[model samples]
Target: MEIRRLAGRVRTAIARADQKLVTFVQSHANLTTALVTAGLALWALSTHQSAIVLRMAAAGAVGYFLGLTPAVCVGALSVGFSVAISLEHGFSISNLIIEVIGAGCSAWLGYQHKMQKVRQEQAADPHAPQVLPWAVVNEIRTSLAAIRFLLFPLHDEEGSRENQALQQATQELSRLEALFREMEQRDRAGEGR
Candidate 1:
């Protein structure tokens, strides 16, 4: 019964955590979108300026922190803007290609960092113990609860009569059910007083 109560509380807590995760992802998306737009606007307004370069850098950093994946949209935009500026600065096309490659590598590194953090969290969070889903848990419990027969050697069955005794014991299921009801009633009455 205590485990049942704990399970109910864990279910509620997990639901709340799921909602928080959704909100967190949405907010990250919005922020990333805003940063990307700002970087593009800056690049369009001033094709060659330190301010544009700084904005591009900021966008790349934010993208790495928020995306949690390589080839993120903001990361792509950052690299795109940087390449365009390099082209405008009279850099060779090869240099622009190198910039894109560097950007890609950095994005991949950021993704790896995010994955490491996730693994660390999983290791540290004991209360978030890994378990089978509810359906699997229910199936296991059901199968165990319905286990009415135990395999026994023929000698044990006849010499000690353990198998027959176990079968007889299983027949006391109704009595156990009544005892459970009585306990429940007593608990309710105690609570009322």
Candidate 2:
């Protein structure tokens, strides 16, 4: 009975620790990535090993899912550290190129993965507004309104193909404006409810 009790206690402790780890990772992902990258760079610098370059690159790629800024910073640090170490050892151009290429590929892969995840989330919630912040959305709308005003004259210009295209564009813009208004009204109605 005592052994069973001890086992249960151990399991509970492990579960609690796991939860704490998850909470920490989620809340401080950017900081965590930065620290991890820094540690990897330091370790590579101390060991003066070329193989560690690959590990740093892998860390950078994985860091992408965390956040772009942190990942980029980490990638830059990794490359810089690798280069510094290489210069001290023998300054191999091929090694420097490889490190640079690895970092670039990691950054690109991470960006693509992040974008794909965002696209998937948007696709899953089609009714949701685009991922842009409200300020950016407002700016874009304002610019579009200006463009529409500029094109307004073209809409009435005599039977040229360009005028016809302009007319269609203006009509489409009106539809979009109506849609935005409707969306705003729906949002207000939702808030009231």
Predicted model with the maximum TM-score: 2
Model 1 worst lDDT window (10 residues): 148-157
Q: Tell me how candidate 1 scores on lDDT.
A: 0.58
What lDDT does candidate 2 reach at residue 10? 100
- TM-score for each of the candidates: 0.36, 0.38
* Strongest candidate by lDDT: 2
Candidate 1 regions with alpha-carbon error over 4 angstroms = 1-64, 68-71, 85-91, 126-165, 171-193
Tens-place lDDT per residue, model 1, 21-132, is 9999875754564455455445445654454444444544654677634345665676677667777667566534534444444454455556767889988985543444
Clashing pairs in 2: none
lDDT score of residue 79 within candidate 2: 69
Give all candidates' CA lDDT scores.
0.58, 0.67
